[model samples]
Target: MADYVKDIRAKVGHMPLVMVGVGGAYIKDGKVLLQERADTGGWGLPGGYMEYGERVEETLKREFKEDAGLEILSYRFLTNFDQEFFTYPNGDQTQVLTPFYLVTAVKNQPAAFDKHETKAIAFFDFDHLPEIHFASHKKILAYLKTLL
Candidate 1:
């Protein structure tokens, strides 16, 4: 969570809010990269909420580096979905506006991910993906699968 969200939660007290989210869809050798999230203990795309004044691509690159330890070298827009509602285990709810990307990572970056937000990182075949944490992520993956 970002400081801006925390500041708003302080006033709203768990009320639903709207947030812009960006994710990277890193596909290689018929597999998609995913992260095991520390917060939900479920698998999800390695990305995060867009901070105020940041471009969507900037958010995606920053999140990939922070959460997956992969630096995004290039990216192409994949899809956008809105009104995706999610409730945190702690009870915070938000309607997320998401834009996903097909990202290419810089070569030689180690997979030393941020332990605070991610537990592990792996690439899974779309057909054999582990349980996805977010329903929106599942939808995104399904759509991406069709492109293969």
Candidate 2:
């Protein structure tokens, strides 16, 4: 969690808060990169919450580096989802609003990833995507496929 979110949670204590977040679809060749999350043990796009005064693109770049060890070279806005309510494993709840992106270029790519929030990273063909962890992410990908 970001320090901003931690500070808010310290005050609110599991109360549902509306938060802004960012994520990206890094499609390479014919596959999209997905992170196997440590928290849910389910595959989803690499992303995280925005910190105070940080731009959405900044958050997306930071999250990709922290979660998957990839350096985002360039990205474009994909779509924004309506607020989606979600509960954390620790009982913290949030109404998350996400801005999704299409990562166009990157570097420092790795074949395997093991991080605090991510268990592993791999690319998957759209038709054979893993069980997605978030409803919003599933919706985003479903919508993205129409453009591919």
Candidate 3:
């Protein structure tokens, strides 16, 4: 969670707040990158919330670097959806508007990932993807299926 979000939650308690975030499906050799999130222990794409003054693409790039240490070389727009409601493990309630993308990684060597956010990061075959933890990500993958 960003400091700005925390500041807002301080006043709102558990009231649902609208959030905008971005994520990417990074494909390589017919596999997509996934991260096992430390918070949920479920596999999902590399992403995080948009910070103040950040563009949507900047949010995706920054999150992928922070969570997985990978640089996004290029990306194609996938889809955008609004999650009606979600309650985090820590009791934060939010209605998230998320934009999804299909991204290609840069050739630069990646730094070590932030263990606080990701338990593990690896690639998985789309046909045999792990159980997706987030409903929004599942919907994005389902849309990717049509393109494949």
Candidate 4:
């Protein structure tokens, strides 16, 4: 409990500073890649917080590799955001993240491995997106409808 509090205190020190991230509709065969959060076991796109000393797009590229085991060809901004809220089953609270990206797969590829961050990674039809952890993801997908 003390550790979590200390971490929250340190994060708060970054004032008005929340996490920025990147994720996308990695579409193939008219379907998109989706992930289930290991912590919550709910569905979401594969992404994580932007790391220090890394370009935002680079973060997306790296996280795609780390979380979904895919290499991105090109990614453009879907939107920049300033909203997200979080809760943990163990009572840990966190600020939700603002994410950006409209990405597509590079080359004809097969699923590799993203061993730690994700347990399941697969493609799903847009109209049939599975029940996901984050409700915001459905909104994100709706936006993708405009793009694709």
Candidate 5:
């Protein structure tokens, strides 16, 4: 997938950029933090693209703090990811190459940001799932089950 993204960058010679994001488990007493993507109005792990000169870990920290409104202690690299393009109702595409990280947060029930891009945010358990924003994301959540 990395190769594919590199190929895209090389082929386009323009910023057909790859986007990465970090989603933490933030498990405390059996809960996980999630955010509803404003794009699809589905519950999803919080993450965004890797910024210029920024590390993957930094991206995770910033994204977690921004979307979940929490201070996180530490995180582990859970997986390297590739998700299919998501098309909006307007027919625009949000194509991305995603990196997922599982982090532990300092707070349990953190208050997330109320913003244009996030419709809702909360914690979800194993038995429950917020309407997932993308099909590939659901696979990521499913992969998480094996880790537990």
Candidate 6:
């Protein structure tokens, strides 16, 4: 979670806060980047909630770097959708409006988990992806297959 989100959660306490977040599908060699989330232990794209005054692309770039230690070389918007209300294990509730991007990674930076939010990072063939952590991500992967 972002520092500002923590502050907001301190005030709201389990209320469904509407948040805008960004995620990227970093593709190389017929594979896409995925992370095993430390909090959930489920595989998902590298991303997080947007910070105040940041553009969506900025959020994508910052989060991919923070979670996976890789910089995006370029990206194209994939989709924006309203996620169903999600209740975290800690009881925080969020309704996220998230944007997904198809991104290419900058060369020379071997992607690795940041060890804070992500437990592991790897590229997976779409047909062999691990169990996806969230329904929104599942939908995104399905959409990606159509593009392939």
Itemize residue pairs with steric clashes in candidate 6.
none
Q: After superposition, how far is residue 8 of candidate 3 from its true place, in Å?
A: 1.4
Question: Candidate 5's error at 69, in angstroms?
Answer: 0.8
For candidate 4, write residues 5-66 as lDDT tens digits: 34654655434334555676677788888886676777888777666667778778887887
Instruction: Give the poorly placed runs of model 4, Cα more than 4 Å off.
Output: 1-17
Candidate 1 residue-wise lDDT, 1-148, digit = tens:
4566777788998888899889888999999999999989999998888887888888998899888888888889977889699999999999998898998655575777889989999999998999998999998899889999
TM-scores of all candidate predictions against the true structure: 0.94, 0.92, 0.90, 0.78, 0.74, 0.92
Residue-level lDDT tens digits of model 6 in 16-107: 88998788888788888888998888999888899887889999989998888888788889888786567888998888998888885464
Best by TM-score: 1
Candidate number that wins on TM-score, 2 or 4:
2
lDDT for each candidate structure: 0.88, 0.86, 0.83, 0.70, 0.67, 0.85
Off by over 4 Å in 5: 1-17, 107-114
Better by TM-score, candidate 4 or 3: 3
Predicted structure with the largest lDDT when compared to the true one: 1
The C-alpha RMSD in Å for every predicted model, in order, reads 1.5, 1.8, 1.9, 4.6, 5.6, 1.7
Candidate 5, 1-148: lDDT as tens digits: 2344345556655433445544566655566667887766778877765666677777777777777677677777776767556655654455576777777546556466648657777778866876777777788778886777
Cα displacement (Å) at residue 79, model 2: 1.4
lDDT of 5 at 40: 67
- Per residue, candidate 2 scores C-alpha lDDT tens digits across 80-138 of 88678899889998888899899999986563344678998888999999999988889
The ten-residue window of minimal lDDT in model 5 covers 1-10
Better of 3 and 5 by TM-score: 3
